[model samples]
Target: MEMFRGFLFISIAMILFSLNLSNVEGRIHYHKKQKKGSPVEPPTYAPSPDDPVSQSPSYPPPVSQSPSYPPPVSQSPNDPPAVPSNPSDPGNTTSEDCVFDVMAFGAVGDGCTDDSAAFAAAWKEACAVESGVVWAPSNLTFLITSTIFSGPCKPGLVFQVDGVLMPPNGPDNWPKTDSKKQWLVFYRLDDMTLTGSGTIEGNGDQWWELPCKPHRGPNGSTKPGPCDSPAMIRFFMSSNLVVSGLRIQNSPMFHMKFDGCEGVLIEKLSISSPKLSPNTDGIHIENTKSVGIYDSVIANGDDCISIGPGCSNVNIEGVTCGPSHGISIGSLGVHNSQACVSNVTVRNAIIKNSDNGVRIKTWQGGAGSVTGISFENVQMDNVRNCVIIDQYYCSTKACQNETSGVYVTDVSYKNIKGTYDVRNPPIHFACSDTVPCTNITMSEVELLPEEGELVDDPFCWNAYGIQETVTIPPIDCLQDGGPEAIGESGTYGCY
Candidate 1:
């Protein structure tokens, strides 16, 4: 009976041990299945030393993903780690490229310091990189001297100017070693863009007081000394350029000038100066082609926009001009030189309190042609000489009436509704005696006196065209058929 009891106890112990081993095996198998099927947390990556964000020690920490988000795709041990979209993430790899910050290159953004060297250095770095951005960060002001940002850079470079740019305070501080004709010049660039919510302050009050400036001398005449004033900004020999969203003000001379550029676009600019500022044209383009200037406001002493010699295929629309000389073509063909301008269209413009609206002036002793010009949908308010073509345009009274002149032909005006100042004729066409204007057409042109009754009539001299619709004050002076040559001197070749 004792042996039987001992055997029974041994059997019970064996059964219990067997049940415990089975439970352990099941738990192990369940854990293996979970390891094969469940998503695994991705490993953290360290940023490489060559990373742009890592190069700048002052950059903020990298931003991290939310805890509730799913894990990232698993990376192989041999593959490169993924870069973080947000560089401030502490747990992710951070990287940035091709953003050349001017402040990072030792620019002191105090409004008084000279930051031109720093800007040039930053531009050099940016120009070498493809599609790089040269950033002038916000909430800062940089004082620069006469600078030339020259480039034959890689495609798609951008000058991002979010901060204020100011020149030296007037003419006294202008650098003698630098050029006196340009404050900021861009040269030889292609496929570039200059844009920002920045202000380019010329600080031109003292420069305007120079004796050589117009009306600054005795008896409202210019003095005969050396008179050289710098334009605020100039683009030279560039192509496929864009300039927009800038506020340029108080220039000593022209606010903006473009020379020898093609495929240029300028829009949404605000340009202003005192009405008495001499030679302060808002925009001036010479030898440019395929240009568009739209949606801009300009108030200055000279022409709001001036089309100089060798310009073609220009379109100016949605522009507002006030206290200015209005839009002008020429003062071209000067000094017996040849000039050519064609295919210019100005539409949807407003000219208010200006000296002239839509004028074409050429010198007497010169040759070339101005053709295929159209001015449509223009509204004038208290403007003088609303529409004019003066072949005898001379700044001084000593201009001699030479036999040769720039031929004006194929010009049309439509929907030109306006009020004139009444001191001058609303439409004055004083073409050259030898070379008369031809094919001048007008339609829907209605002009009335701003103050009193219409005292002056529309004047024309040797101008020829057909009036599609009757003008306000009858222009009986215009000849009916094509222009008749006065003599053999009327024929000249335009180069």
Candidate 2:
């Protein structure tokens, strides 16, 4: 029995020893695996939190704590902890919304002629802006002559002309493209804005067309025609330009012309014209795209709005037109010319006391296409011819071959409400006899005369190039005016 008891004790002791050895071996294997490919190798010793050294590319075991462990560095006088030097940074990473005072930026505080020099300096400071704003504070009248300021406008260089920019009023002393008004013209620039509640007084007495009616010219020489002159504002090959909150008046020619621009927003503007001036249109856009003219008032002698050839995606909304020839599309081309006008929308516009409204005037003969046009929700008061589309559009200027071979196609006129006068008919739809109007659809045309005399002068010329059946309603409201309608003799005569 004693021998058996000793054997049992020896066996138990052996089992216990085996279990302890297994635990030791497993721990060692696990620790080796953890250290083999871990992102954070267990440091031989914990490092101090104050240590400035970063992880070295050489992932060797750290040596003894030494001063060299920290990166060799120095402090810069101008350098901040976290900022960049380029002040015009788009992100404003430096957070420098330049707090420069107007006068400090070369703005003349006094209302005088010396403002030209100050304006020149202010413009220079605004040129190199990635996102910079230049101020033109109040209480200053800046007189500018012919000054040309070239522009490849940076993302955020603004001309905050808070004061008046008076345009010199003389042909010899006027601000021409070579001289003045070039102050803020941008060429092929993106994301630029000119916003202010100031005025651009052309003081256009000298610029106005002196009577060329066989009378002495500016040099006291004989000249032809009624007058010889053009407008004030001229833009060439610019993009993403915004003109807002401005009042421009007394323009010699067309008030505003946007030539070869894309993405233009003209809003909250009041443009006027001298009622006696001839051929003075409100706005003329040529070869432009994605343009919007909204919430503005235009009063001029000629057409309130004229869309030249090569314009697309244009929108005119919430506009008030008066003392003008009304809205027109194309005088097309003179001869042997090509034009493409498409994708235009005019809505919610008011036409008052004008010769015509919602008009599309193309030459009788020319090569052009006007498509995807819409005129909706229009109101006209005391309008001579509320809606006029003259394809054989012979202007006051002499005719060439009777027609210019231009074509008008794809148009719509909906919800046009107006009161026709006695002398002038409410609707006159005259398409070209050769190049007909195609896909021209009109609906909800309410033209009832307020005058008593109802004479019937209804006419519809053939739509030359179309196969669809064209129809003219027999309302007889187009030809004869009501009793109260004015006399109709010449272009402006209301009989």
Candidate 3:
């Protein structure tokens, strides 16, 4: 009876796989606990039209038997987004006229001291002065508690972080009066440069063990609690900002979050966190515009860079990401919300030993459109899902599929060469049945297996696109013939 049940489960899974009805989890964990066998070799060309495997453009069959149930959904560490610190000192060599040092405003550089007040005082002083410098002296570890640096500050203010700034020890150490949503926030600031080769540490060891974290519960279930963890640094509703030349690490949640901000430039930085740290996204940008992220190294638990809802005109280049979930355009349109994102590009990047390469994910029951995005000149090494577009992204297995879906179209992948982990498919584009992805183009994509095994085939469902050049591990799965509504564009601009 047990053997019969197992056989029945395998038959059901095989039917689902053949019909392209399986979810993203089913596709990713297709190799879970399988019996050892000879690796399936990648096909050099598309299957013949009459071939049984040629019925769909979705991925070809694996050698292993399909599992009974889908794997658990990988939830983002960030949830229940309600919305969207400190200081200081002067032992500086730069003798600027508008220098407002925190130490001058009664800031103790001691690592144990709560210097939030002093940092706030210095910012207040400098916000009024043009081209002012809020200096945190070198060789100091200034401990700061929760603080919000509200701004519409004077143009061209520089917050030179030459030392270390750390938050409170843990949740137990947090002050009841302060909100745990975000630790240090630059709110509504303009023409500011937050730069310098300094370190901003979240001291997030305790936060990772929280009940709400992904690995804390049985089968990745969540335990009940306040479950709120603070983001390390957030720029909210700020414009003309530059965050560069810093080392940020170990965030309770997202290391850097930009929400409702515009005209931002992030460059020349190193961001990191433990691979086990929950939700420690290197940099997260949302509801922001005209942002450029360049020349950065990010090794973190979550996405190296995440482009969230209502974001446009984002450009990322010269980034090295590893030991992380690679750059993601989203798990957007969550909870049936509308997500509008466009004009994003990620190029000249390297992603190694990451869970994903370049991914664009959206939930099932949502509205809005994602268009005019391109991923070019990206190199991957041992990446699990080298390139993917998963429209039915549910964080829980219990989520029911909905007809309403976000529109994803006009995406191009160019010069994406890499070696992928033998586990997951090299490319997976599982678009919604309702709103099919259109005008997807790929060129010069060569993904081989990192280990000495055969490469996996690309997977596609309702993904209509044109391949400009022949791709490695041939994307025979990508469907041809896009809709007439696409190919030509007005609002999203001609790709």
Candidate 4:
């Protein structure tokens, strides 16, 4: 037929060119085995999403999983549990239907039922849930009174409070128009977070047995009229705040007040009262700013962290304070008033059995200025005036020495090791014949004498600074800044 139809078209064109070269060598051996299994080796440490430990540090990832209680006990077993310097800190994060369950808003945990209208209707539905959480469940004991949970909330709200909250059993059930001065306020809030592991209990004996309670009058005297007791948690004009792991005890007067706050973060708190429990004061800051009192434990009756009068950038750490009145920054500008504290910082503290250890009282004529203060790594046991700076602060002993004080400057005392209760003077520093406390600095101060009595000699006046590494009973009464020798025209004379 035409050479057998051209041999069937040359055997079908050599079997279609050998099946197109075996499908092009099987797609070039499947792209050379996917280019030799290319994953491209690019991971060495690769974790930075803001790195809260790129892979494992557990992180602030343990507010629960089993926390039915047990962890607040920290009186410095070397204080190792204060996390949150931003382990994803959104004021200490929380979520899940925005958690608002104070016994589901009927709130009768039963410690005598007054739950303040179910905690003001669960803080008005957790101030409208944005990250809200009003939950207070664990062992349960509610009982509030003299409330006021007002707020401009919904920005990470969280008043967890796991248990007891008692108040209102003293001052004859207190209602005489309620302003006993505070009792759990929290007005005008912002990113708030009053944490858990609860217990508020301010049933302050009968407002500490009234008569204006300075131990009920008689020589530690007080007999004034209203004298308003009560301040067991105040926080007015708040900002991104956080008062953590609370356990605040008997109060009737100052035990956690922070007014006009801003970025506060009092952590791991556990304030108690009665050392004679008079003015209470265990964590009070006024007109606060960038505050951060961390890892706390204050025993109490005034000043276990009180830095009042327009405080600025305050920061205390690993606290563990004492049987009262030790970490104060003021009696500041009282009444002659016009204070202005600045950048205060206390660090790694532990002032046991204290009456005074790192104080800085001011009162005489009171004008402005207490600048950049710092007391570092302090640790005193039998403490009683182990580093003071009075400025003639008189609360009695018939006052009167006014001259225009309060200008302590750049104060610093670092690594203050110690045990001192030789009565007083382990470093006194009177200052202010007219504001004469300038640039004082001490380093590695070691104050011994727990009762082996012999360490006194350190009582400067019109203080003036600089001792770098030899200060146990040897500060030699710091002086040397002149205006004629000390102040007011000098020669040192303000007793």
Candidate 5:
């Protein structure tokens, strides 16, 4: 009985040992499978609070947490990000709100009604904005009296005209309270642009017929009266201005004038008047600098382009002038005031049937100097005195000759070829005896008589220069050496 009991105990012990060994083997196999499949499965445990890489948001969050994530779409890498279309933003101001129409300001577009008040209202609103346009609608004519468009306005201001602008009909209709010196004056403006396909008509027929005009009286006599005719348009003390694409006609006096201005540009303009009209200069500039006038046409009685005192750095190109006094430097130093001009260039011009071509005239007893002037590639047709410099320019028949005069130096003429009137010499250089002209250069000049044969030789008095090539009607009269010492006129400098 003891032996049987011992056998039972041994069997039970063996069975229990076998079961324990099987459980250990199964745990080892499960661990091996988990190690092999680790890369494909998500993490089963949370990260520690101190792990910086696990806390960072650079990686994508879970789908339920990331509500603002954009959908996958194809786009260029360089393209800008999309923005909302918000009209209330200052940068997105609409064009309709920026345009200030004159009609909206209670302007009557009829030919007779006065529209100065409406124009002033429009200008006030437009000038107040950051970038504004003052618009004159099409198919209308607005009569404006002598008015001033004053400004120190915001930048990017534009005055756009698509219609006609007319002044009072004649001197009879002119308002007595208005000043007759200027009409349509623009003052104290910067970065302003005046552009239009329009007409500015100055009804000056009666003003021109006044007896005070030169040679208008019987037998060319002067009738004593206060003769004040208004300039059509004048710009004063303005900078960085542009005027383009307009037609101006029939001015009482000067068509357009610029005074005390800088950085001015004028292009593609047309100016016309009767050839016999008095004091109707097309474009005049005084005390102005850094100016450019290009691609324009002028047919007027007086000078096409006049450069007055204190002007420098002027450039004129591609201009056509007819029936007018061709481009003149000055009737400077009137009443013996100081005048200085320098660095002027005129190129690629045509002067046809004009009174003079490329002239420099100064009154006697004038101070200061004119230097660094050039005229190149000019064509003249039936012009009188194709190239001239007259130091003794006087309006009256009898004038006193003074010892002091403006010094003229460094003038050049190149490639000037054309026909000239036979009544006067093609080239006349009547320089001041006291302040002789110096450094006058000429090249490739060929001027032939328009009517008869060439009867007169080129005239020169106290002018010195060299000719690079043989000229027609050879100018042997020019002195070969430098100018003589300046006479009693004291040394002058730019003011």
Candidate 6:
């Protein structure tokens, strides 16, 4: 009987796989374990016509010697619709400057001596009360340090920035690495909203020495990168945080890093940094869950959004990028860490003039599993590397690539449309050569790539397609950026 049950399970799974149904498109269904006497409703799947597998369940060849079993339902009279939880917090209401009924913040834009004292005063006041608007009015360069973000995480606690929260300039402008204080940050805050038509500038040049780290230490640098200004907004180990409709730019490191937090909503935010800046990931999230990032614009040299280790149950949708590295997961398993990223979805995103469009990059020889990840309805233009799934992406100095072996599994991409203009290799699906990637699937993904000159990938003809295949054009990454003329203006940059 046990052998028979194993056979039955394998048969069902095999039939589902053969039909080429993506996890996103409801092409596959399996029975989940249920309690005795409990009701069981089989999932509905949309199977492919080209597939020989059953669209509907078919009966097994009869057990001629035994009593007959009941057939599964053909249709149900009534069933509750399934609801996929989105990361967006719709309850976060929109508010305009001055019209807001919350605590007013930051010395009303005097443009004189640093407004840190004023900002400190207002923020402290807002915290003292249960709820209020904390405003950064126009023209104010609010300088702040080690401001504790103790919030009720409620709408009553509103943070409005109508002006600039600028970081101090020169070396003195650096966030005190001695302690994680210097710039404005939020920790253990909840149900709080940061909304305004203003800017958060960190005078970052003072710490230029950090980025050129010739040494190594904790947090990825012994000598921290100059880009490591205290975080723009650090919602550490907190949840239900909402940041909407604000321009959060010029951070030392991450524009906003929500670490180990849940129920985070970042909407209509313009998170920016200089394109040449290093380690300035627009948003870096790690060890968190239930987060939504939508309707936002991010321009940076690093990952627009870096979904780091131990992240699960995340939804990233409807975002646009500029001069970014696109969205990514992993670079995990650093410093002997066992990280797992799972149950996340990214959809309806546009990436322009970026290095890589959408990717999952893992430390080639780490111990972690990246599973059940979905990318849907992605549109790309002028992208350098349209798609990548690198399992052997090693960056750490201690890595012995020839010895350490890691693998990636169960990743899906659906309905991706893009054009790669640069001449480099657009798609590098170099999964772990040893422990090969398993159950990796793509559907309805197309890439039209062209550089200054034509270059093609012979192996690319066989990629994902729901209705059709992923398309790719040819261009030379090396030749595309060359000078058009040999004289004055033509003597431009070199490779």
C-alpha lDDT (0 to 100) for residue 42 of candidate 6: 19
Please identify model 2 stretches exceeding 4 Å from their true place: 1-102, 105-114, 175-184, 213-230, 402-404, 453-458, 464-495
Better of 4 and 5 by lDDT: 5
RMSD of 6: 23.1
lDDT of 5 by residue, 392-447 (tens): 99998887988888888889899999999988899999998889988899999999
lDDT of 3 by residue, 1-495 (tens): 999999999999999887785565566744444231112332223322133311112211112111222212211121211110011111122224466656666667779888888789888887887667776766678899988888788776777787799998999999998889899999988877787667898899998999878869888788887789999999999887777788999999999999999877777889999987888999999989777777899999999999998887777889999999999999887987888888887878999999999999999877788888888899999999999999889877898888777789789899999799989998999988778898899999999999987878899998999989999989987889875552211122212
TM-score of each: 0.80, 0.68, 0.79, 0.32, 0.80, 0.67
Worst 10 residues of 5 by lDDT: 59-68
* Candidate 3 wrong stretches, greater than 4 Å: 1-95, 483-495
State candidate 1's TM-score.
0.80
Say which prediction, candidate 2 or candidate 5, comes out ahead on lDDT.
Answer: 5
Q: Model 2 misses residue 310 by how many Å? A: 0.7
Q: Alpha-carbon error at 98 in model 1, in Å? A: 2.3
lDDT of 6: 0.58
Off by over 4 Å in 1: 1-96, 486-495
Q: Per-residue CA lDDT of candidate 1, range 1-495, in tens?
A: 899999999999999999999998878743332211112231232232233432222332121122222213212122222211111112322223555667667777788989898789888987897656676765678899999999899876777676788888877798889788889999999877777667888888888999998788889887887678899999999988777778889998999999998877777889999988889999999998777787899999899999998887787889999899999999887998888887788888999999999999999988888887889899999999999999999988898879888888889898999898988999999998888999898889999999997457888999999889988777888889885464333335533
Better of 3 and 5 by TM-score: 5
Clashing residue pairs in candidate 3, if any? 57-477, 85-184, 89-103
The lDDT for every candidate, in the order shown, is 0.79, 0.59, 0.78, 0.73, 0.80, 0.58
Q: Which residue pairs collide, candidate 4?
A: 230-252, 487-490
